[model samples]
Each structure stands twice: as structure tokens, then as C-alpha cells.
Target: MNYQALFEQIKKKKSFLCVGLDSDMKKIPTHLLSSTDPVFEFNKAIVDATADYTVAYKPNVAFYECRGAVGWRSLEKTVIYIKDNYPDIFLIADAKRGDIGNTSKMYASAFLENMPFDSITVAPYMGEDSVTPFLEYDNKWVILLALTSNKGAFDFQFFEENNKKMFEKVLEKSQEWGTKENMMYVVGATKAEMLSDIRKIAPDHFLLVPGVGAQGGSLKEVAKYGMNQSCGLLVNSSRGIIFADTSDQFAIIAQIKAKELQKEMENLLIEYSIL
Candidate 1:
């Protein structure tokens, strides 16, 4: 989906929430295990329940890929199910892939071309060639990892040289390769305070922010600094929403959790005059 289409969904749903499908086989409800594909079934239920309150869904690839061929099948089924049922919802393959140009092309084809994801999270460590391949697709996005929320992020992301932090250089240099239309940055919600500086650099680009609920990132702080004229944020919550309850009522609980965030987002949008 294009940027306008994404904002349209946010407007229609009164949310910029992106439900993360970090479904782990061992973590799903015992009831779902009887199903042929527990992970996909768990995802389908979550999607159906929370689709109304979310604008995007991100399926973290590691959760599926770890299970090998069967896991891959479940991932594919989950993707098809969402596209076939909720075509308007943006889908992201959270693969965090970045490799040589040739390898990146294959990864792009796998997710963006063959699987029909609207975007894929990518690591920018390998530089332009590793990222540009994914940007080749029209209306698709490359969500390059920037200042992540993890404690380890400080190990290198904050590295300074010539008065510029490593992530700052990433924010500036990447703009030369992809426009705001086909590119975004993965700015962790835990780093909300730094958002003001990030916005000064990439004012219009959307940010796929993780670390909100489970990671203790404040939603209000994210909006205060990161929000733009279009409410440029896709704040995600995985365990806090999807795994909130592991009983038969998991989906219902997921819906409730999603709605709580959506309502908060609606208020923020209005406060920021994006509504």
C-alpha cells in the first residue's frame, strides 16, 4: 500500500496500531494445538478479532522460520488468510534481512513479490546495495532498523564520529537511496525522547515503532515527538496484545487489548490535529 492508503486506514480505524504476529508454537493456547497448523490458526483468530482496531500486522519471520518447512507453510497460510480477508490492512514481514545485492534481491522477491507483503523490515548495516534491492518494488517499503529499543542498541547505534551518531548517519545517508514514499525507519518507542531529533531529519517518513506495551515505551511520548501531519507512526505491541491471555478466550482478550491502544491512539490523533 502507498503512504496515503496507509493513512486512510489509520483515519478509518482511528488508529495507527500495528499488531505484531510474533506467534510462537509453544506459546499458543493448548486448544489451538489440536488444529493442523496451530500458529496460523492462532494468527487467524487474532487477526479477525483485532482487525477493526489495527491498521497494520507484522509477522516476525523468525517465529515461523524456526519451525522449518511446516513453519514456513503456516506463515504463508497466515499471510494469504490476512490478504484474502482483510485486504486493506498493511502486512509487514519483520525479517530484518540485509545481505549482498544478490541475496537481498532474493529476499525481496520472497516477501514483497511472492508473498505479497506491503513491506519488510531490513537491517542497513550492509549499506545501500543491501537495502536498495527491496526498494525496487513499487508501493513497497524498506523499514530500515535505526535506533532500536534494546539495551544492546547502545553498543553501536549511539557510536559517534564527526559529531554524528551512527543512527543519525543512517537516517541521513539512507534518504539518498529511497524516498519517504518507499522507505521508513524502525525507531523504537523506548527511544521516544530522541524522536524529536529523528523528526528533524526525516520529517515525513513513517516510523514502525516497537517496544510500546511490553517494552515499557510510552505511547504519549512517541506521539509528542514523532507524530507528523499524517500521524506518522505504526506503534506495535506483541506479547502485550496477542499473548495477553493463553486461554480459549485469547482472541477476545487480544481484541480488548487492541481496542485499548486504539482508543488511546484516537485521542492522540485528535490532540495532534491529525483527526
Candidate 2:
């Protein structure tokens, strides 16, 4: 999906919530395990329940990859289901992949072509060569890891080189690889204070923020500092929404959680005069 389409969805739904389908097989309702594909079943229910309140769906690849071939198949079915059913919602493959140039191209093709994801999260530690390959695909996005919310982020992302934070340099240098249309950065909501600096470097690009809810990041603070003219933020809530309940009514509970976030986001959009 293009940036305009994304912004329109945000405005239309009064939301910028991206529901993370980080569905774990072990964590899903016990009854779902009886289905032919429990993971896909869980995802389908969550997607159906929360689709109205969210603008995007992100499935963290690790959850599926850990299950091996069956996991991958579940991911494929999940993406296909989303495309066929909810064509307008943006799909992100939360793979966080980055490698040598050739390998990166293959990874890009695998996710953007074969699996048909609208975007994929990418690690930027390897530099431009690792990321440019993903940008080769049209109307697809590369969400580069920037200032993450993890405790270890300070171990390296904040390290200074010539007085500039490492992640700041990553944002500045990555602009050469792709335009705002096809490139976004992952700014963890837990690190909301750093968003001002992030905006200075990436004023027009969307940010896939992942540290809200379960990670205890302030949604209001994220909007105050990170939002742009276009309401450029996709705040994700994984565990808080998807795992809202472990019962058979989990999906319904997930929708309630997502709706709460969407309502808050709508208020933020109105406050910023973006909607």
C-alpha cells in the first residue's frame, strides 16, 4: 500500500493501530489446537475481530519460523487470508531480516513477491547494501530498525560516533536508499522521548512503533512527539491485544483491546488536526 492509502485508512477508521498477530501456538485457546492449522485459525479469528479497528496487521516472523515448515505455511495462509479478505489493510512481515546484498534480495522476493506482504521489517546493522535490495520492489515498504525500545538498544543504537547517536546516523544515511513512500523506521514507543530527534531526520516517513501496551510505552507521548502532518505513526500492540484473554473468546477480547487503542488514536488525530 502507498503512503496516501495508509493515511486515508488511518483517517477513515479514525485509527493508526497495527494489530500484531504474534500468535503463539502454545498461547492460543486450547480448542484451536484441534483445528487443522491452529496458528492460522487463531490469526483468522483475531484478524476478523479486529480488522475494523486497525489499519494494519503485522505478524512477527519469529513466532512462525520457530515452528519450522508448518510455521511458515501458517504465515503464508495467514497473509493470503488477509489479502483475500481485508485487501485494504496493510500487511507487514515482521521478519527483521538483513543480510548480504544477494541474500537480502532473495529475502525481499520471498516476502514481497511470494508471500505478498505490503511491508517487511529489516535490520539495518549491515548498512545500505542490506536494505536497498528490499526497496527494489514497487509499492512495498522496508521498515528499518532505528531506535528500538529494548533495554539493549542503548548498548549499541545510542553509541556515539562523531557526536551523533548510531541510530541517528542510520536514519540520516538510509534516506539515500529509498523515499518516504517505500521506507519507514521502527521507533519503539518506549523510547518516545527520542522521537523528536527521529522526526528531525525522517520528517515525512511513517514509523512502525512497537513498544506500547505490554511494553508500557505511552501512546500520548508517542503522538505528541512523533506525529507529523499525515499522522505518521503505526503504533502496534501485540500481547496486550492478542493475548487479552486465553479463553475461547480471545478474539472478541482482542477486538475490545484494539478498539480502546483506536479510540485513543482517534482522539490524538483530532487533537493534532490530522483528521
Candidate 3:
């Protein structure tokens, strides 16, 4: 989807919430395991329940990849289901992939071309060659890892280089590879304080933020500094929403949690005059 379509969706729904379908077999309701494809079944119910409250759906690739071929099949079915049923909902493959030039090209083609994901998360540690290949696909976004929400992110992302944080440099340098339309950065909500400086470098780019509920990141603080005129933020809540309950009513509980965030996001958009 283009920026206008994304922004319109945010405005129309009064939300910029991206539900993370980080489904794990261990956490889903026991009854689902009896189905033919439990992962896809869980994802389908969650998508159906929360589609209206969320503008985007991100399925972290690791969850599926860990399960091998059957997991991959579930992922394919999940993406195809989203594209066929809700084309307007921005679909993101949270793969966090990056490699050498040739390999990166294949990875890009696999996700952006063959899989029909609107965007894919990519690591930028290998520099332009690793990322530019992903940017070659038109209207497909490359969400570069910058400041992440994990605890270990501080070990490297904040390392000082020439008096500037490493992530700050990543944001500044990666701009040369792609424009805001094709490129975005991952800014963890847990690092909300750094967003003020991040905006100075990437004023127009969108940010895919994780770490809301389960990770204890402040939603209000993220909006205060991360938002732009277009509400440039896709705050994701994975465990808290998808696993709201381990019972048969898991999807219903997930919708309740998602709507809570969406309602707050609507208020923030109104406060910022973006809606």
C-alpha cells in the first residue's frame, strides 16, 4: 500500500495499531491443536477478530520458521488469506533478514515478490548492499532494524561511534538507500526517549515500534515523540494481545486487548490533529 492509502486507513479507522501474529503452538488454546493447521486457524481467528480495530498485521517469521515446512505452509496460507480477504490491511513479514548482495536479492524476491507481503523487516548491519536489494521492489517496504526494544539492543545499538549513537548513524546513513516511501526504521517503544533525536534524522519515515504491553513500553510517550503529521507509527503488541487468554475464547480476548490500544491510538491521533 502507498502512503496515502496507509494514512487514509489510519484516519478512517482512527488507528495505527499493528497486531503481531506471533503465534506459538505452546500458547494457543489446546483445542486448536486438533485442527488440521493450528497455527493458521489461530491466526485466522485473530485476524477476523481484530481486523477492524487494527490497520496492519505483522507475523514474525521466526515463529513459523522454527516449525520448519509445515510452519512455512501455515505462513503462506496466512498471508494469502490476508491478501484475499483484507487487501487494505498492510501486511508485514517481520523476518528481520539481511545478508550479502546476492543472497539478499533472493530473500527480497522470496518475501516481497513471491509471498505478497507489503513490507518486511530487515537488519541493516551489513550496510547498503544488504538493504538496497530489498528496496528494488516497488511499493514493498524494507523496515530496517535500528533501535530495537529487546534488552540486548543496548549492547550494540547504543554503542558510541564518533560521538553519536550507532543507531543514529544507521538512520542517517541508510537514508541514501531508499526514500521514506520504500524505507522505514524499527524504533522500539521502550526507547521512546531516543525518538526525539531519531525524528531529527528521519522526520518523514514511518517507524514500526514494538514493546507496548508485554514489554512495558509507554504508549503515550511513544506517541508524544514518535508521531508525525501522518501519525508515523505502527505500535505492535504481540504476546499481550494474541495470548490474552489461553482458553477457547482466545481470539475474542485478543480483540478486546487490541481495541483498547486502538481506542487510545484514536485519542492520540485526535490530540495530534492527524485524524
Candidate 4:
């Protein structure tokens, strides 16, 4: 989906919540083990339950990739199910991939073509050539990593280059490769204070914000600094939503968790006058 369509969805639903499907086999409810495609089953239930309140669904690639071909198949089924049923739901493949030009193109095809995903997480350490290959797709997006929430992010993102933080430099430089239309950024919600710094550089770009739930990032702080006139934020919640319970009520509990966030987001959108 293009940025405009996504924004419209946010306005229509009064939500910019991206529900993370980090479904792990071991962590799923035991009842799902009886299903032929347990992983897909789990994701489908979560999607069905939360679709009304969410604008996006992100499947952390590692969960499916680790389970081998069966896991991969499960991932494909989940993607196809969402596309077929929830066609407007933005699907993100949380595969943080980046490499040389040729390799990056291959990775891009694997996610954006072979499998259908609206966007994928990308590491920017390899620079423009590694990142832009993913941007070649018309409506697909490359969510470049920036000011992440992890503690270790300080080790390198803070490095100075021409008196600018490394992530700031990444934000300034990558803007040349793709506009807000086909490119976005990963700014951890835990780093909300620095969002003013982030907005100064790329005020119009959408930010795919992780770390909102289990990672303890504050939604209020994120919207306070990160929101643009367009409500440019996709605040994601994973385990805290999907794994809210491990029983027959899993999907129901997940729905409640997502609704809580969506209600908060609705108020944020109103406060910013973007509703």
C-alpha cells in the first residue's frame, strides 16, 4: 500500500497500531498443536481478533525461519491469509536484512516478490547501495533502522560523523535514495526523547516504532514528539498483545490489548488534530 492509503486507513480506523505476530511454536497455546499449520492458525486468530483495531501486522521472520521449511510454509500461509482476507492491512516482514547490492536485491525479491510484504526492516550499516535495492519495488517500503530502543544502540548510533550522530547521518543521507512515499524508518519508541531530533531531519517521513509494549516504551511520549501532521507513526506491540494469554482465550485477550493501544492512539490522533 502507498503512504496515502495507509494514512487513510489510520484515519478510518482511528488507529496506527501494528500488531506484531511474533508467534513462537513453543510459546503458542497447546491446543494449536493439533492444527495442521499451528503457526498460521495462531496468526490467523490474532489477525481476526485484532483486525478492527489495527492498521498493520508484522511477522517477525525469525520465528518462521527458525522452524525450517515447515515454518516457512506457515509464514507463507499466514501472509496469503492476511492478503486474501484483510487486503488493506499493511503487512511488514520484520527481517532486518542488508548486504551488498546483488545480495540485497535477492533478499528484496525473496520478501517483496516471492512472498508478499508491504515492507521489511533493513539494517543501514551497509549504506545506500545495500538499502536502495529494496526501494526499487513500486509500492514496497524499506524500513531502515535508526535510533533503536536496545541498550547497545548507544555503542554505534551515537558515533559522530561531521558533528552529527551516525543515525542522524543515516536519516539525512538515505532521504536522497527514496522519499517518504516508498521509504520509512525504524525509530524505537524507547528513544522517544530524541524524536525531536529525529523529526528535525525527516519531519514528514513515517516512523515504524517498535518497543512500545514489552520493551516499556511510552505511547504518550512517542506521539508527543514523533507525530507529524499526517500522524506519521506505526506503533507496534508484539508479545504484549499476541502473547497476552496462552489459552483458548488467547485471541480474545490479544484483541483487548490491541484495543487498549488503539484507543490510546485514537486519542493521540485527536490531540494532534490529525483525526
Residues 1-275, candidate 4, lDDT per residue (tens digit)?
99999999999999999998999999999999999999999999999999999999999999999999999999999999999999999999999999999999999999999888999999999998999899999899999998888999999999997789999999999999999998899998987999999999999999999999899899999999999998999999999999999999999999999999999999999999998
Q: Pick the candidate with the highest lDDT.
A: 1
lDDT of 2: 0.94
- Candidate 3: stretches off by over 4 Å: none
Off by over 4 Å in 1: none
Model 2 worst lDDT run, 10 consecutive residues: 188-197
Q: List, in order, the clash count of every candidate structure.
A: 0, 0, 0, 0
Q: Can you give the lDDT of residue 208 in candidate 3? A: 94
User: lDDT of each model, Cα atoms only?
Assistant: 0.96, 0.94, 0.93, 0.94
lDDT of 2 by residue, 1-275 (tens): 99999999999999999999998888999989999999999999999999999999999999999999999999999999999999999999999999999999999999999997999999999998999999998899999999888999989998998889999998999998998999999998987988998999999999999989888899999999999999999999999999999899898899999999999999999999998
lDDT, model 4, position 139? 91
RMSD to truth, every model: 0.6, 0.7, 0.8, 0.8
On a 0 to 1 TM-score scale, where does candidate 2 land against the true structure?
A: 0.99
Between candidates 1 and 3, name the one with more favorable TM-score.
Answer: 1
User: Candidate 2: lDDT of 157?
Assistant: 92
What lDDT tens digits, residue by residue, belong to model 3 across residues 1-275? 88888989999999999999998988889999999999999999999999999999999999999999999999999999999999999999999999999999999998999998999999989999999999898788999999999999999998997889999989999998888898889999987988899999999999999999888899999999999998999999999999989898988999999999999999999999997
